[model samples]
Target: MLFISAITFGADYDSIGDSTIVRKRSDLTQKLYDTLLSIKGNGIFFGMQHATGYGVGWQNNNDSCDIEKVTGDYPAFAGWGASVTDCNIAQGEGFEDARYKIKLFHDMGGFNTMEWHADNPFGGNCYWERRHDKTKDVVASILPGGEKHQEFLTQLDNIASFFNSLIDDDGKKIPIIFRPWHEHTGAWFWWGKGNCSKEDYISLWQFTVNYLSDEKGVDNLLYAYSPAKNDSREEYLYGYPGDEYIDVLGQDNYYDLRQDATNMPRFVKMLETLVSIANEKNKPAALTETGAFTIDAKATMPEDNWFTEKLLKLIMYNDKTRQISYAMVWRNGSTSHFHVPYPGHPAVPDFIDFYNHPYTIFMSDMEKYRTKNE
Candidate 1:
């Protein structure tokens, strides 16, 4: 499979990379970047995680989504997870389902992003498993010359195989934003700040990118570096793998915007810094993951209009922050643990208002941004 360069698209591809990373990027991948760059400064695209797979009061139903159920349209961006793609047979079934959903969304002119909550490689239960008194340095162990190095390569191979399998009806590859090791600034995951040294973390990120792009020949991807929320820009770029390896700068913030809407100024400050850094580096930025856990099993929302008054206000606060490419809420797991409002929910009217606002883009408004190949 010989991939062609994106010279015909008239994109400033050099700005995206100065190495082989951009050279091997597919034409659709470059077009996606151009599309996102054109969208910046105009409007922010709304997105949802695991949007079509399941939703509140539904599971694996065909052609249905919670956002569409409420807003009469689907989100412009759809997020998926690849945590169990390389796991056992029972777990790998989820990856197969994701492949179908990804292709379906792509065919509808919706953009896609993927994250990995990869299980801990060193005998731990899940990705959240931390290295304590009885565990090894997981990040170090998966690097170039450690004991679990071969196992890590096998995992990457599985992911690469999955990436290669995403094809359109015309048999062209579908481009997606691959975000791995997200929210690493927190101490909850195995790859968090305290669990791994800064050098080891950097090595792990660069190695993963190199392995997928160079060794495995996976070209239909745009890499994104997303860290947890940070007070200063320095904290956000703690273990950044350099501009050559990253195409987007993202931040996963749930505390300031969701926990207490009154603390919105902190989120605004972080957004300002994020957009500024993205501008300086010539890359797109996004609010990777965020949503008020209002309709949870144990708690209900204090305010009825959290979407318009809280989430939308945080993004539309200033011109710079509004330039963010997209803002995605979490998934709609069930009636109790959903992020977006479902049918008959009190937040429906306010969410509709947010959808009707010119600054917010959904799938219905994405026709103008379609690529030539698409």
Candidate 2:
């Protein structure tokens, strides 16, 4: 089978030297295109750093929701969102049994990240507590230490196999959006803050995609490249393995750290840059994860809602960027250290307007996409 590789985003098309691009009529794969062109974002996309599923281990009865409740909210994606978490651990049950209910959720029609493990990327727990210790070996599984080139490939292989076990909302192979090491530019977590080099990071991302797509049978995945919308457009902003290796180009930002408000423009400009790149290369843009750090009780801050409402509007109208497809919520509201968005807050109102709003006009454009592509 022939393959056209866009090694680096927006690289010159004619000269294919260090890069790879195999052009043939039928070379494009359905899964590959899904990553690059298809698979629009779920607007009310909510993420759970620590899900209630972990309560399954203790039979504690607090795993975030009742099976009945989730079942009732099954396809109520109107304003309701889906949960994605690290570990995918079942607190009351074993990994296997916990995963079974997880599959059941999707069997009824739902979507989730089936995420790789994380140590509270934006600060919070995945399964209530730390979920699991910093078992980077169990989670990241990178070689303890070795040459950056050799180690990157080895660890990538391990991460792919771990995530491949999941099923999608159809109870079939889970077409998960695997987002491993994200927001490397931020100095917040262990993964960033000079913990790893750029070459090391890029190699890991590329190798993971190759292993999953070519080695493992996980063709149902769209690897997401996410970064905390940083103030400066630092080098880490675009540190990807190229369009071929990455399925989606994404960014993650929040109103938690600063109330100064200047970060908003930085976010808009950075997203504009990323979306432009994705659009030029036939890839779509996504706000993979975002949220405010604090939500007051009873009183929903209209001020906070303004933040939610305005940022969303900017993503849609920005001229230099691609059409912003998904604006997800980083739903880890329980953590005290750092977190802004969570459930039951007025600011995080039902965003059904994405489909209903005249600004987005999503359904109409979707029809155009379906017709033009099909």
Candidate 3:
């Protein structure tokens, strides 16, 4: 499959030097285009990060409990986060679970995306609490020939091995969107705005991708570059590692972080910004992470139809915003930290309505997308 340097997003997909990777990426991209493109703009896909195979309901009940266990259905896209704590942790049980879920989603004709919550290489700092003081010099350590550079490579190699291992029943590589160093605009993570220079960040990104694609020979993945919400396109693309290194233009935002529902003007504005940038760049854009972070819709039922009223309305109703390929909510970690609603939860009725909406595509709907594309 011959590919060009510049890709017209909705029309074609770009390559990153690997033939197998190029084919898989192009196939997935075409699938996305077929599913989303419509005469009346496009359809938006509903997603949930770390949803089935693990969730708040599972934490509260049995490990077998999941979105399908409760609601009898799954989201169109499922996300997983791998943490490179010890250099070889990607080969451990946690990562094995993630791989299992990825295969499960693929077998069902749904999509899968993975991101990293990399630990600070210089010290004992974890992803969530990566303060500047704790991991300020970490990025430098991971650059070529830096003190921790070799250690970082070990992590990437293991991660690449995992990506390469995701083969389907027919012995074909399964495609997945791989997002790394997400929420770079936030002040928390070690790789965030204050911790590293744009030069260093771009190098980190390019090096990681090259090591994965060239050195490790992993070709079943598409790279996604996601940052925290920023108002202007300039601010959003400030540290971007250029078009060749990225396949998906995505953003991560939470309702609680923005202090409002999905209909919030600020939220809509950022969505517009992402969509406009994607359209101009001829790339696919997505609301990579979102949802009511802390609200227990079941207990409080605070905002009725938060799904259809706020979120679905914002994505499905708008002409331009509807072009966003997908919108994913964060993980349902616990009863206190859950994002999506469980079965019999107060938001179930509204979520059901959102799932039923023609513009909002979920897991079962993917069969139609596959048949249409076929």
* Highest lDDT against the true fold, candidate: 1
Query: Alpha-carbon error at 7 in model 3, in Å?
Result: 9.2
- C-alpha lDDT (0 to 100) for residue 102 of candidate 2: 49
TM-score of each: 0.90, 0.62, 0.85
Residue 106's C-alpha lDDT in candidate 2? 40
| Model 3 per-residue lDDT at 305 | 71
* Per-residue lDDT of model 3, residues 176-280, tens digit only: 788888888876777788777888988898788777866877766777888997877888897888766777889887643332344477677788888888777
Task: Please state the error at residue 267 of candidate 3 in Å.
Answer: 1.1
Q: Give the alpha-carbon lDDT of every model.
A: 0.79, 0.46, 0.69
RMSD to native, candidate 1:
4.1
What are the runs in model 3 whose C-alpha is more than 4 Å off? Answer: 1-40, 57-66, 84-95, 126-136, 255-263, 294-302
Model 2 lDDT tens row, 201-239: 666666566655666555555667777665544543546
Candidate 2 at 213: error in angstroms? 3.6
User: Any idea what lDDT model 3 has?
Assistant: 0.69
lDDT of residue 220 for candidate 2: 54
- Worst lDDT 10-window in candidate 3: 1-10
Poorly placed runs, candidate 1 (over 4 Å): 1-23, 85-95, 125-133, 294-302, 371-374
